[model samples]
Target: MQEIHPLLQPKKYRFIDQSTLGPGFSALQSFAMDDALSISVGEQISPTAARLWVHHNTIVLGIPDARLPYIDKGMDYLHEAGYEVIIRNSGGLAVVLDEGVMNLSLIFPNSKDLNIHEGYDAMVEFVRFLFADLTDEIEAYEITQSYCPGKYDLSIGGKKFAGISQRRVKQGSAVQIYLDVTGSGYERAALLKHFYEISKLGEETRFEYPTIDPSVMASLNELLGTSLTVEDVRERILKQLSEFSEAVVTHPLEGEEIEWFTKRLDQMIVRNEKARENLK
Candidate 1:
């Protein structure tokens, strides 16, 4: 097993939990908040932060997903299925987010000094450390049949439960990962599969969309044979983060941070507007 990097273990870190935010709180705000914190941490206004977030019944699409030939049709399907859709300001294809899915963003400073893979390796190592007691089988590799499949996809026994992605701004970087903590990963994959079936059935696209196989995905609860809620894993995250840092500071977004958030949030809205124009 490879050793965890020292960069991931900051001496001091900021912890922010937005997972308890009610349904009315949009995932859009989470994206903007991360971007703002990334800039703040990069500029030394805030410590390197770990933020926990969850969004209910939302399908966050990548830029390419918005270009699907019959995406408007798929958008209607998602709307009818009670899932709010938005295009994220980062890489990766469509991914499902519900109460059972937990999102983590590790914002770090000095992006210029860290290579992209190093950032992803830090996240992969952190996650491996988080669940070290549960299972040593957790592996990071592309589960090609899963939505938002990537080389850093985290899985156990051939079933994917999480995916990692990175977004960089200014001199700060946010390495994000979404873990299917509870409920059904297969159901989520099925939803995305149906979406692609409807969205690209008749269209010939240049981009190679994933052929989602529902069996290839399963939640951690199912894989570990433990009834773990997102809150449970949230606690696990906090505990592991505490072990990695000397002090964990709970910081609130204020003043200039709020301003940055508002600006980035508006930009996110504008980006989504263009992405969802035909769908709406």
Candidate 2:
């Protein structure tokens, strides 16, 4: 008998699935939603949340990537490749997003006992449990050659399939993960490689970026040898959360939460504006 993760206990949870909301919400809006939701949960107005979201063609950049010497050139390349670019308020390098990818944000009330690594570990355990029937080989470690490399990167058989990042607001912890569900992971990896090649131009920079190798990344469908779609993965998450929680409620943002989201959205817009102005 394997030990169960604390996150998987039968507790109450709020489920929000924005994956089918289409392309109307930008990455900026999504981040704002996460922040606002975190605040709500922290204030005890809501329960822990498991939000699922998907965006069309977009490349979410980290602050460090925005500071690249030739970031303007990189943005141009991404734009030419038919990707909308935004700098995310998170800790990580560039990551690709598409219809085939699914993003999950697990928001919890921050506690003195819940450290940063513990939050990440909870997400890792949740994911592994979600797919336990399909495979038991999921592992979390930094894949050095993959973009957005981190100690908590989720991989299997030495190829990375997902990455996780964390954000905290008030007393809420939003642990986020993006899963490459379907499509060509290599192509996405190659796009970032080209962006980096143009952005860095072999310049000796103070910040060290990962040397991306396209082959080091792979979609879950490719790794698991199944025709897994984003919808399939989304359903897996919902079903697992239902099994883990005594009650999984779906609710919309209310008046005060909407106000908070509005303010955070404005901040996101301002942040993007600054990033774009730098590209000029």
Candidate 3:
């Protein structure tokens, strides 16, 4: 496994530890941060980055999630039930996030010669390495019963605790994954399942939706039988990143990057508005 990871050889890596940014923030704030990082990488003004984030009571939806028959009602339900909803410009269906959910995005160059598999492999390897001390039983396989199930879903003992997604902009790619580090996996899965049931309302669509199984999801705290908080995992990520490379660079969005993010966020807001309007 070590042989496979170092072989990929990303040019440079930056690790952003944003896990302490409270339990909740606006989706636009997070999008702005990603946009800033994307611009930096695309311009070759910065190295590759592994960013960690966590948000509370938020339901991040895919483009299709907004098209459900009663999605407007669902969004209202989510709001009434205390969850902020937003559409991500990436792959995957709706996912629940809270203080327990840790999100990491591996940002890398996307040149003509760069292989897509390289990005995917890098994430899979990084995750395995982070938890090497805990257990080596984690496997990369499709956990269909899990919400937002995908081929690259990260699982342990056939129960999913993480899902991977990717977003590319110009010459930069951000491979994203959300790790359920702690809290009630059933509660989270139930949230997503209810979101689907309320939104889709048995409506048939061209895309096949996931039939979320609450049983197939488990938090690190539950899976390991040890209480592991998101902060603990965040620290582990920093430690692993520091161990993996020399001179790990950590910094917030620069002024120049912030300007670019502002522009990108406006575009994101426009896209989100369209999605919301569709639901209405």
Candidate 4:
């Protein structure tokens, strides 16, 4: 689907703008809240949430990321290096998160008519339109050598700056993405590459994971040849959401949502524990 056609599918997205949250409680809380909100508000609410959040010096790893042969060593490396590594209950592999990185979650109610590809396409289309003013060359193809390579890896000129993943709770689908708004994307890639090397240590596994070439990643500031900050992209995100919605209102996690998050947080911790065990 191209520009005009996809924009026509204006699914109402909620605006949970928390663009300046740090490590520990804030990141964990927001993720758990949104994960639970996606399920509780799925079909009944039919409300899609567009959340913007940032965490400093954190590495959000995928479920499979913990399956790396050298995971213990990898996590140790990251921890010793002063990065907080946590396993995310979403799709995609390990990705660096910091104040410079901006994350958006487009939560949609899953209709019987919608499949996984459609869910992925909705975000692909939303993102394409989100940056329509900048350039139309953004392609959603698998950028090999890019960490977390998938069909939804959004790239410009062969270098990837954004990756999208999905989380389904009941009938709600949360398509989340981490945009490397600023900073050294190559540095992040290098870190993942090192993580892989430390984990694998030349041992073979059936999973067939990525070796990460570091060169295939770069920040939007580097790609655009201009100094653009996460706040700049954050503004662009708000403007784009307004263009697609009937009303753009800021909402917080309700008490019920908080309770669901508490439960989900426990599940997330369990998943993280199991993930960490796989590294050994």
Candidate 5:
């Protein structure tokens, strides 16, 4: 196994887990929270932080996804299907978030000196370490037929189970990943596939959206043949963090961090509304 990146070797890490917050925890707040942590870490007010979040039955779309010719209809279809849709402030196509999916964010400072691929590699290495005991077959490569496909997509046996995205703010970087811990990955992919089908309507567009193949995706439980819940993965993450750092401290947002979160949340709301309206 490759050595973990130095960025992952911090002496202390601030840990925040929001996975059990239930249905009210919106993806918007999650993104804003990451931004606040990024700014705090970049300014040296806080140590490098790792946050865990989960949103129920929501579809987070990339900025370009808003430009689909018939996005309004697609949004309606998702809403009618009991899913909340929002545009994320990061790069990546649409991805499904549900009780079965777990999202993790690692915020690091001095991003100016950090290569983009280095940040990604840190995440890849950490995940592989987390599941090293279960299987060593995890691979990082573009799973072209999966929803939110990217070069950093994590897969096993050519079937994707996770996708990663990164956002930078105030010289700090947040490397975010969504892992399909438990559930039917095919159902999730089929949802996004139908979304693109309705949104594009076969209309030729400049930005090419992925042609999702639901069969190319599977949850960890399905692939590993072990029933692991989101909470199980959450425990594994905290355990690994403790082993990697001198101390893993559970901390809540305080002082200026709360103010930063409020501002970032407002910005995200405005950005989302404008993107949706422009498409309409």
Candidate 6:
């Protein structure tokens, strides 16, 4: 087993658990919240922070996804299928987020000194530790046929259960990951497969989008042969975080942090609107 990165072992961590916020807690706000936390940590106004969140039936698209030849039609299909769509201000292809998916963001300061791979490694190591008790077969590598495939995709055997992406801002880094803790990973991947078929319509482009194969994905419950709910994983995360830190504190955003969140949220909304305008 690889040693946990020092970045993942903070002396103290500000832990924010928003997983129970329900459907009203939009992914739009989640991304903005991460930026806010990044700035807060970078400015030394807050300690290294971790946030857990879940959104209901949303498909977060990458910037390139927004440029798909028939994306307006693709968005319409998703809307009809009862999924909200948004373009994220981060790196990676499209990914599914729903009640069964648990998302985590680890915000670290001094990004200038943090190598990009270090941020990714910290997340990989932390996740390995999160479920070390349940199974030791967890692996990190690109699951090319899976939706949102990446070099840091977490898997068991040959099936992927999670994907990691990172964003850097104001000298802080947010290494974000989405874990498919429950539900059907095949159904989720199928959604994206249909989405890409409609969005690209067999049209070729400069950047190649993934050719998704639903079988390449599976929920943790399926892989580990254990019934693990998002809530179950939520508790596990908090417990693991406590082990990694000397103290775990829940600190709400205040004053300037609130202002920063609002500013970043507005920017996200504007970006989404502009991306939509290109379709019209």
Where is model 6 more than 4 Å wrong at Cα?
none
Q: Which candidate gets the maximum lDDT versus the true structure?
A: 5
- All candidates' TM-scores? 0.97, 0.97, 0.94, 0.92, 0.98, 0.98
Mind sharing the TM-score for model 6? 0.98
Measured over all alpha carbons after superposition, the RMSD of each candidate to the real structure, in angstroms, is 1.3, 1.2, 1.8, 2.2, 0.9, 1.1
Give stretches of model 3 more than 4 Å off: 7-12
Query: Under the 3 Å rule for N, CA and C atoms, how many clashes does model 1 have?
Result: 0
lDDT score, candidate 6: 0.92
Tens digit of per-residue lDDT, candidate 4, span 164-243: 88877787777788888788999999988998889889998987788799999998878877777888888888887877
lDDT of candidates 1 onward, in order: 0.92, 0.90, 0.81, 0.79, 0.94, 0.92
Clashes of 4: 4
Q: Give lDDT: candidate 5, residue 232.
A: 91
What ranges in model 4 sit over 4 Å off? Answer: 1-12, 25-27
What's the distance in Å from true for residue 144, model 5? 0.6
Across 1-280, the per-residue lDDT of candidate 6 in tens digits comes to 5677899888999999999998888899999999999999999899999999999999999988887888899999999999988988655789999999999999999999877899999998899899989988989999999998889999999999999999999888999999999999999999999999998889898889999999999999999989999999989999988988899999799999999999999999998888788773
In order of lDDT, best first, we have 5, 6, 1, 2, 3, 4
2 against 3, candidate with superior lDDT: 2
Q: List clash counts for every candidate, in order.
A: 0, 0, 0, 4, 0, 0
Count backbone overlaps in model 3: 0
Error of 3 at 75 (Å): 1.2
Candidate 4's TM-score reads 0.92
**Poorest stretch of ten by lDDT in candidate 6:** 271-280
Residue-wise C-alpha lDDT for candidate 1, range 63-179, written one tens digit per residue: 889889888889899999999988986778999999999999999999988888988999988998988889999899999999999999999999999999998989899999999
Q: Which residue runs does candidate 1 get wrong by more than 4 Å?
A: 278-280
